[model samples]
Target: MQESISVCHNQYILKPQSIESEELENATFHAKQRAIEARQTISPWKKSHSLYETGGWKSLFENINQPLNLSTQSKEFQTRYNESANSLEQVVESAKLPLCPSGQPEIGNTVVFGVVGGTVEAPSIAYLTESQPVTEEILALSDSVKPTEIFRIASSCQADACRHFDGANCRLAVRIVQQLPTVVETLPACQIRSSCRWWQQEGKAACYRCPQMVTDNGYSSKILQEVGDPYSK
Candidate 1:
C-alpha cells in the first residue's frame, strides 16, 4: 500500500494539515493550486507529513507570523537622519566658498601671491599685502617654465565641479593636512587665508604646511607627489 499521502489521480496529493496563520494557510493553498495547474509539482518525497505537520515547521511558521517591531525602529532612525541632514545643509548653505586655484592663468578668476626661489625640493610662497590679478604680462615671465613654478596663484574654490572635491569636502585639502609636515608654528600671512579652501577645510594645520606646497610639483618631491595625487587609495 502507498504511504499516507500518495498520488491518486495523476496529481501531487497533499494531505490537509491545520495551519495556525490564516494568511499563510491561504497563500500556501493558492501556491499548491498553482503548482498543480502548472503540471510541474513535486511530490512531498521527504515524508508524508513533511509540509506542515511537524512541530518544527509549525513553530517556524508561527514565529514568522509574529508582529515585527522594525517599523517603529525605522521611523525613529529616519527622524534622527533627517535632523542631521538638515543641520549639515544649513552649515553648507551659509558657509563662504574658499580658494582652490590651480597652476594655469587661463583658468580665470585668479590672483598671484609671488612665490620666490621655487626649487624642486620645496617652495616658500610670499604673500603680497593684497593679491595681484594674474595678467598676460605676468604670465609671459614664465616662458620656459610653468607659471606655477614661479607663482602661487589663488582662485575661488570649485566645490562639486572640481575633481578634488569629494561631494561635501575637498580631498586635496584633506591630503594636504594628512601627508605634509607643518613648517610654521604661527599661521603664515597669506592674501587668501580668510578665503583659502585648505584653511577652511583643515584650519591652521594646512596654513602651517602651506609654505611647502607647490602648485605644479612636476613630481619633484615624493611627499608632494603623494599629497597631490588625486587617485591614491
Candidate 2:
C-alpha cells in the first residue's frame, strides 16, 4: 500500500534583522529627528484627498483656512483646533498606507487592496527606522515561487508630466520594481509632489511621508529594518 503526504500553505515569512545595538539606536533617533524637522517645514493642506472632496474646477480658489497653533493662548481655540485636527486625522488615516513598526518600506514598493504582504507590522515612524535584509533571498525564492501580480491605485496623477505616471497609470510598478535594488535608498520621493492634489490641499510636502519615499540608497545594518527569509538555512 502507498501512503500519501499532505502539504499546507502558509503566509510567506519575513525575517527582518534587528538593529537594536546601541550605536544604531542612537543613529535611528537622530535620523527620526531630522525627518520630523523636514515635515514641520511643509504646510498642512497638501493632502490630495482634501482638495478633491472640497472642489473640482474651483479647488484653487477655495480657502484652506485651517490654522495651526504655533502658539496656544486660548482654551476655546485649542479645543476647536484639536477637534478639527482629529477629524482630519481620521480622513488622512484612511488614505495613509500601513507600514511596518520598524519603518521598512513595503516590499515590491507598492500595495494592492486585497494583498496580504503589502503591510508591515510596526508603527509608522518606528518602521521607518528599522533595517531590512537584502533581496538576494527573495531572488532565490523567486526561482521556485512565481512573482505575484500586484496592484496600485491610480488617482489624479494622469497629468502626463509625472515620471512615475504613464499616461494615466504608474509605470514604476513595472519599470522600477524590476530594477529595485537589494537595498533601496530612501522611499521613492513623490514624483508627483509638485502638482499632486494632496500637496495643494494640505500645503504639505508630497508623499515624502510615504514609507516608500526614496530617501537613501539601499538598506544598512545601521539604518533600515532588514529583510530576510526564515525558511532559509
lDDT of 2: 0.26
How far in Å is the alpha carbon of 173 misplaced in model 2? 2.9
The digit string of per-residue lDDT tens for model 2 on 11-86 reads: 1222222223233334334334433343344333323211122113122223434322223213433343345444
Model 1 scores worst on lDDT over the 10 consecutive residues at: 48-57
- Find the candidate with the highest lDDT and give its number: 1
lDDT of 2 at 59: 27
Residue-wise C-alpha lDDT for candidate 1, range 27-92, written one tens digit per residue:
333323332332232222322221111112232223333222334423543344345454666435
**What's every prediction's RMSD, in angstroms?**
33.2, 19.8
Overall lDDT per candidate, in order of appearance:
0.48, 0.26
The candidate that achieves the highest TM-score relative to the unseen native structure = 1
